[model samples]
Target chain A: MSSAEKPLIGHLVIVGVGLIGGSVSLALKKAGVVGHVTGVGRNRDNLELAQRIGIVDAWTHDVGEAVRDADVVLLAVPMSAYASVFAAMAKTLPEHAVVTDAGSTKQSTIIAANKFLPGPERFIAAHPIAGTEKSGAGAAFAELYEKRLCVITPVGDSSATALALVMQLWEKTGSRVVTMDAAEHDDFLASVSHLPHLAAFALVNAVRRQKSEGHDPFCFAAGGFRDFTRIASSSPEMWRDIALSNRDALLGQLDAFQQELNGMREALLADDADRLLKEFSAAREAREAWLAKHGDGL
Target chain B: MSSAEKPLIGHLVIVGVGLIGGSVSLALKKAGVVGHVTGVGRNRDNLELAQRIGIVDAWTHDVGEAVRDADVVLLAVPMSAYASVFAAMAKTLPEHAVVTDAGSTKQSTIIAANKFLPGPERFIAAHPIAGTEKSGAGAAFAELYEKRLCVITPVGDSSATALALVMQLWEKTGSRVVTMDAAEHDDFLASVSHLPHLAAFALVNAVRRQKSEGHDPFCFAAGGFRDFTRIASSSPEMWRDIALSNRDALLGQLDAFQQELNGMREALLADDADRLLKEFSAAREAREAWLAKHGDGL
Candidate 1:
């Protein structure tokens, strides 16, 4: 267990309690850090399920009312809904309440927070690099953030107390916390997460388009293709908002990836066996080294 | 156990005796389908290891010597070694022996066999669509082919007896067998297997090239990147040969993939959230459906 101090709070309100929000509630509740967890979501069934699973102490559809007494507020809604969610909560949120988010992109999230929330300095933007292809409150678990990396992107004028509280919250979830510039977080995640997802989606669509009269390519798709495109099965609605929210960074990542793909294509076209061998060898060595160091956690 | 009739062979000679070859030997030996298994490989240590592990009953360095009295011959060497292996075995191959292979690419293996062997009709080109990242005789197991798909590509004049024997052999290994034209097999595998492997390798290299000071993108790579690039850690040299051997089909796959990626890039650049959402939704639905049907096995 981590020796880091646990986040002490009376009421922790989680908006849009799906996998991320529900998981945060579960982890904090398990650590005995928070007195009570209030889950707010539009979906009644989902909220009921979260409460039934002990992921929340209470469930409600009223976001503003739920956070009236919250010491800390976690906005786990989709990026597309952040503006509306923030606008709804801004008017009723307690004056001293600290805010944080589990959004994948940090820059846009921070932007939304500044535009709607009165206490922008209290909003700490954090993205825990964790999750499976599975989503929803049903997929939430206390251990989802175990040994995961969490990046906190605090704005220039952000309150140190808010950032510290958010950092401690993630620490209680077993996440290693590191601070990064919001733009840097967006660019880094674009290359490692967003870009790979777009590639996987495109790869699957490519094969689907190539389906011939008598054959289904997917019938023969084995473990390699399955694992390689597993992310293609993630929430399309969630990913669409992400792709749009961090468009510029994602575009740069796509361009970088296109260059690599083009190089491999040219090597194959020219029948340059040596070049292909060298390229594949380098990738294999790098991936192996990373796996050796990380133990395949992600 | 399969209700299907088991393969019956006197002496089964498996060249290369690595994962694929050794697995076949193990599976057949467990089924009591072959009288004796003779392993052949350039590496003396590997051959001895296969024998010690009981994957093979005997070991030999000479392909011709091993196949002299064999009823079945499985060529499982790397694609680059096919021509040389075929040429060496052709001189002393028994007239009654049936030849088959576990090569990834069918057209090149068939071409090599036809060019070198007197009895091209006796060679049934096959690829059991199964494997792990692990390799060598030590990685071999009897259940490796259980419930996996095996594609057999027989030439127009391929001997019926040879094809039947090969089909029975795969069936006894617990594989679901399907026969297709060599060209069709190459194209199908190019879209499903080769293209995915290349994509994974390129994605890894793209991230590697973007490495900057104070940031290692891999440290933040989560489940999405891990599963999407798992195949990148596969055997590079073997994949290099597959890419080169099936160059034309793979190039076509690359072009198709490029088109899909370009479409995504356009959507992102245009800030077209609807198009991106539709694309991702379709991919997610398709992948989920495939998983539901195939159960994630190779």
Candidate 2:
């Protein structure tokens, strides 16, 4: 890679070397976005694994020590752990270090982050719309971010230089960056990502419970069930944190969705085939309209 | 290929060379499961396309003529159209012809099958859970069933030999077969397939309606939004048929799903982070548990 195109990152620090965090480090190193990466995690085993994999240049358990003198810090832990990590090092971040994150809930994370960091402007929140249902260092991949959307949630008066650097880093890692407010990001995400997770979980649970009543439970889980509930195979701890952190927005979204479903249910109960068909047609029309915008079939 | 492992089919008749229909023809032919494949479609042009693509050895607009001498008749058309096709060809089918279908809802399809064919034993309901958002003969592929699940919904005293032949054809094309009750198949599929389609359409409409309110909604359409709603991109005509045909099961499923969402919303409204976390965790836990049993994940 030419020097100009080379990832100009040097002395990078990554907090929580799990799937998202670990994958980001590998991709950064492979893309030469960062010259060196320091892995930080509360779990010594994870840090050791991250280092042994040749992804992390160095590692430490001390939050401030790991981040001190680093040009960039990437928090890749669960939303629940955000406050503690930030509180541990927020008072000591260097003047020029751009602090970013790979957490799911942007608004709450930023709120937790604001409580610890002295300079809020130095922080940039990112949600990479990439990840498998898998987690941990072993799940890391250099191509994880390729063609994925990385939403940047900007808080008050974020420095342009810092924002641009974060954008450039993600772009180098093969992600398209989209900017939005933290609240909007949370609400939109709840409807799209969080709600789906909830739906998948509930559907699976309902069936599993029914199976416990002595029916062959998993017997009916065909490919459609597998695909529809794929994300349900996610990290429970991480999802729990996300659900808690983005509680209000997710709940609002859930209510809206459930109400629509109830309406459809009523239509079905009355044998209102025409009304049901109308609803289905409306949804089909909307979906087709959206897909047309996504460079797919007309 | 080993003789025992070689494709068992010598002649295949694909009735209704539409998307899934055409795809099945292409896949079986490419896998060497069918030595000579005949194509049948209401649209003469589609049959021509299937023949041009090398998936069809012969082309015919008449369903009865196409399956007259064929070893297998694969009904690859809409569930709504199955009755009409069966009505046209039931009397002309070869005594040895194993008739199978690629319908979404199985119970209704089977019930309808009984009306046309005195020989209900020859009919087998199969759902290959592999497809793209696109449709038609132009989108046919040879490996559509590779590593996919093909659900077989069989009725009373279905011919063992005929079922075996249908099963062998799918297995030769790299599909895993799961035998299920036709009614249960409809219920399971509604939650896993139909609901997701509805959700996708709702999400698209939510955003589209926002755009109509002068919001440049497309700007907010990030990767998460697109992937989460990708099912909405499926063929409107196909989905419309599914939603209507599987109305009862789909409606029941919609009610259950709505209740789950409503519970979450109530928790959120109450600022019951604890309850929100509990429900979300339940969803996550339930999904993960189901996946561990069904998914490659541990």
Candidate 3:
């Protein structure tokens, strides 16, 4: 490989061989950015599938052994499992190893790293803002993160070397790296990602309850409802963990959204057509403008 | 044509030849179920385009002339213009003409028909539960209503002949016809269609408010948000009219949804992982099961 395409790390250990972890490995493998990738997970079938699909160079169940001599350790599991996973790696992580993560939330991940990682300065919390409703090793591909934004929220006192390594790792995978404060990242994501997911879940339950009253609407739920509730088919366990991990930010967003919803309800109740018209027109204009501006970025 | 494919009407007059109206004309014309289609609209350009595309055989700016010699009158204007359009057609409609509509809400249309039409029995209020986000004659297609549900709400003391003629018209266009009470149709549609639309609009405004405060969450919106807000980009004026016409039912739905949202907010505030998990998991399960059961129908 050319110097520009040289591997960034000697040995990399991925703690979860699922969608996010598997995709990261595949992207790095395609770019020749890692010397070797070890898949560490409890699911042997998933790990085997990842290795069979060429996402990892090998498979291992022992997280401690996998990170013993690794140059980079990536925690790619659910947020709820971060504490135990970090503790396991802390016991055997190499002295010079840099740590990173692909969790959706940042503040929780940083806290876990601070408590468990030997040198929390080596941990760079990252969230690659890209995924489908599907999960598991079977859903991974090298292009999953291509041209997607990967926000790297560097905790205070992070080592420059560790930050540079994490930044280069994502850039080589065709991701646009952006830096933001961990708290701000969590707050922003709570509105854009977490809140939307919860709203979809709530919508399905509301409609289902109505259906149980003998007025089934699913038969007429075509273009609009299908698209709107598509994410309601996402993994339940994953979403539950995300909701609990980012409780504060998610609750704040939910409150803001309730205020907006109440305003709409009041307009409808008071028969205020002008107010309803203004709200609907403004929303349509803003959404159309955003789509035009981010047509490619999205 | 075969006996089953026989023409259903002699001359069909379609007022407001936009997406719904234009599509009905095209579907009937392609099936050879109508002898001729006359398009009526304030926009001469749109009428001409509809005729040029063969959605209508001829065009007219005069509603009187269009319905004077017609055997069937299809009112496909926005809900807001129903009263005026109904009154205009009432003056010149042929005695034996079967009047029908393609409005979203039924109770309001039925009330308009009662007030404006000389013989309310001849006006069968109908709603074809199918459409794209697009509007205007240019976005119409011949198969837009194929296998779609068309709910016909027949007023008490209606003429059987007029109702039969209207049913035959939709059936000829490959639509599955079902009869429902006008009030019941309005209530069901409020939950499935109008409420979802309002929620989507409110969500966009809420996020936009945050963006104005310098934290733009839209930049991170992905597949879920795009699908959920796709309907937010629909015609604002049309939605405003629907919201007002079905004010009572829409308000009821808004209340129900608010209860659900408030429950979610409380769960998040209390950090009740179990409640959040239960809600998310139940929603995911129900949605997936619904999709499986209605896969082919949708």
Best by DockQ: 3
Which window of 10 residues has the lowest lDDT sum in candidate 2 chain B?
B208-217
- Candidate ranking (lDDT, best to worst): 1, 3, 2
Q: How many backbone overlaps does candidate 1 show?
A: 0
Residue runs of model 3 more than 4 Å from their true location after superposition: A2-6, A212-214, B1-7, B212-215
lDDT of 1 by residue, B1-298 (tens): 3436544987899999888999999999898788888999989888889989998889888987888888999988899998888888887889999999998989988888889988999999999988876789999999999999999998899999899999999999999999988898898899989999998999999988878899888888876777888889888888999999999989988999999999999999899999999999989888888889886464
Candidate lDDT (C-alpha), each:
0.89, 0.74, 0.87
Question: Interface root mean square deviation of every model, in Å?
Answer: 0.9, 4.0, 1.2
- Which candidate ranks first by lDDT, i.e. highest? 1
Q: Model 1: residues >4 Å from true position, as ranges? A: A1-7, A35-37, A48-59, A133-139, A296-298, B1-8, B52-58, B296-298
Show the lowest summed lDDT stretch of 10 residues, model 1 chain A. A1-10
> Which candidate tops TM-score?
3
DockQ per candidate: 0.76, 0.25, 0.77
- iRMS value of model 1? 0.9
Q: What digit string (tens of lDDT, one per residue) describes model 1 on residues A153-181?
A: 99899999888888999999989899999
Question: Per-prediction TM-score, please?
Answer: 0.92, 0.72, 0.95
Model 2: CAPRI class? acceptable
List ranges where model 2 is wrong by over 4 Å. Answer: A1-13, A17-39, A48-58, A64-74, A90-98, A118-151, A156-179, A212-217, A259-298, B1-40, B48-76, B83-102, B110-181, B210-230, B266-298
